[model samples]
Target: MDTTETLQGILEFIDEHITDNISPEVLAAQAGYSTWHFCRLFQWGTGYSVMAYVRNRRLAFAAYELSSGKRILDISMDYGFGTHSGFSKAFRRYFGCSPGTYRLHAHSNRPFPPSLPGAYKYLIGGIIMEPKFVTLPAIKLAGFAIKTTSVAGENSKAIPAFWNDYMSNGMMEKLHAEKFIKKHDEYGVCFQEDMTTGEFEYVIGVERKDDAEISGEYHVCEVPPATYAVFSSPPSDGANFAAAIQGTWNYIFNEWFPKSGYEYAPNCNDFELYDDRSMPDEGKICDIYIPVVRMQK
Candidate 1:
């Protein structure tokens, strides 16, 4: 099903049940998506979380009722607030005035009701190839590791440089000599996020046999078996390499996932595969793997 179509269905549902208590879980189930995936998609598509969107829509209607001389407590309860006080606090925060004041003198300042745009548009252009779904068996990787914040753009600066450092300092040749090196191909592995703090470890390494001996700064990390959504980059010639790669990621998260009806499999690691077939400076060809599972309907 098209994501915009699914979203439109949800919007119709919301409009029909505006006065009813609505939660993320409720909407997600209605849309046949996992709660986490649904929340992210809702925010991306409409610029608000399910709860925030509902609150804003309700507040707009409540303000309209206030102008109609409806009782404050009735208006509050009608919008799913447990008490008048709770509604009033939220109202004041959102509108910068108490409901009473708004009703009496600030009718002109009522917030416009929230609406969803027909579709989210992307300004960047690229070929967004349909992903090949594959299951990766459990494996271990060993190589240089670095700590990075989950914050946007932090890893952007660090990762490319990490790759360069690894290549220039002879780390590649050193690892290739190990008996346990499973293959000549290299892996860029991202650890599962530590939710409590927005931090994760990024490792650039190669698959190694279980009994592989390791020495010095190199470390090992394990990956569990899982299905993946794999995206391929256009020939990453230096000129368009970064843009092409980043645009592919944008398409996956912004365009593909919402429509794919899949959620990231919890506790699975995501990784990039680069082998002799790739030319980081010239063709820069590589495959990106995202762990995923079908969302329970």
Candidate 2:
């Protein structure tokens, strides 16, 4: 089978076994690819990591069952949720409300977006731009760091709240007063602690002077010299900046990286740059930097 066929098979498997503990190894084997290759293909094809796809589907199913008059706790347990609170939190993130509220207004909106059969359709149909490549020198960054995981869609929720807290806490002025900041732009840098576990440390801060004093409450880290593929979003529309950033990332991973002739550089930093030019409500015009190396032929 070709790539499309393989992906369709995997999707079918997930649909048939929605409640099963579908591990990556099992899915990769069914698709006839190694774990690494399967993950890339699955992510590019579905616009979601394997685990994310499963969780979203399960929640969607729960949404369907909620309107059927089933008890919330029973529905949650049916979908492998160990606790009603856990299920409620996950459901809220997916549907923008608690299960109880969603059931009351069942006609409000579709529980989930349509899952594409394969990546090629959306990737080719979207206007994904070619990124500019730049070699950046080592730079120092200062900000608060939080540990988050990509597993079970946690990072999607945690990272945005991290930025909101950083800005609301007046971190920008504090960094600027120390003269540690450069160009008045903030940076959100992702440091991978363990790729295998999808856990990373995210620092929300500004570029700091090389000799800036470290704070006990905050963090200081150096971004080493590397070649980066830089992607820029269209000018901010003064509304919903987070969603726009999320869209840009979906295009990058699903559409760009697979075709760009480069793979992510191992053990390096990936970051987003935002500046004063950005609107508080809408979000700043942003540039995303991903360290990369030439794809081995």
Task: Encode model 2's per-residue lDDT on 208-241: one tens digit a residue.
Answer: 7666566676688878888999987655465646
Predicted candidate 1 versus true structure: per-residue lDDT over 26-77, tens digit per residue: 8989988776667656654554557766777788778888988789999999
**Candidate 1 colliding pairs, count:** 1
Highest-lDDT candidate: 1
Give residue 296's error in model 2 in angstroms. Answer: 0.7
Give me the displacement of residue 269 in model 2, in angstroms: 1.6
Root-mean-square deviation (CA) per prediction: 7.4, 7.2
- 242 Cα displacement, candidate 1 (Å): 2.6
TM-score of 2: 0.63
Candidate 2: which stretches are off by over 4 Å? Answer: 1-126, 279-284
Pairs that collide in candidate 2 are: 278-284
Q: Candidate 1: global Cα-lDDT?
A: 0.75
